[model samples]
Target: MTQSSSEEEEDKVEEDKVEEEKGEVEEEAEEKEHEEVEEEAEEKEDEEVDEAEEEEDEAEEEEDVVEEEAEEEDEEVDEAEEEEDKAEEEEDKAEEEDDRE
Candidate 1:
């Protein structure tokens, strides 16, 4: 009877140790899962930031193109006005000569 009691005591101790180890392993796994989730969130945020920056760059480029086109149109208008002024001056000179004749 005494030997059987000792064996039963050893079995209970072994079960306790196994339960403790299992608890530790579960805790570690939960911590790892939490860390992985945080890393994934950070990665997603970085991707969003990159996309925003790309969009901003594209918008700036488009604005520069529009400004260039506006400048070109202004130059064309100035040239056309200069040509009109020259034509008017020639017409006025011809009229003066005919009046003298």
Candidate 2:
């Protein structure tokens, strides 16, 4: 009868150890899953920042092109005004010569 009682106590101790080991394994798996989720969130944020920067660069390039075109148009208008003034001066000189004759 004493031997039987000793065997029962040993079995109880083995069962407790097995339960503790299972709890530790479950905790480790939860921690690994949480870390992976955090890493994925960070990667998504980085991608958004890169896309914003690209859009700003494209807008700046478009503004530069518009300014260059405006400058070219202004130059053309100035040349046309100068040619009209020269024509008026020649017409006035011919009228003065006919009056002297």
- Which has the greatest lDDT? 1
What TM-score do all the candidates reach, one by one? 0.84, 0.72
**Cα lDDT of model 1 by residue, 33-82, tens digit:** 99999999999999999999999999999999999999999999999999
RMSD values, in order shown: 1.7, 2.7
Best by TM-score: 1
Clashing pairs in 2: none
Worst 10 residues of 2 by lDDT: 1-10
Off by over 4 Å in 1: none
> Candidate 1's error at 82, in angstroms?
1.6
Q: Which runs of model 2 end up more than 4 angstroms from their true locations?
A: 1-8, 92-101
Per-residue alpha-carbon lDDT of candidate 2 for residues 1-101, written as tens digits (9 for 90 to 100) = 88988999888898889999999999999999999999999999999999999999999999999999999999899888889888888888899998999
Model 1 TM-score relative to the real fold = 0.84
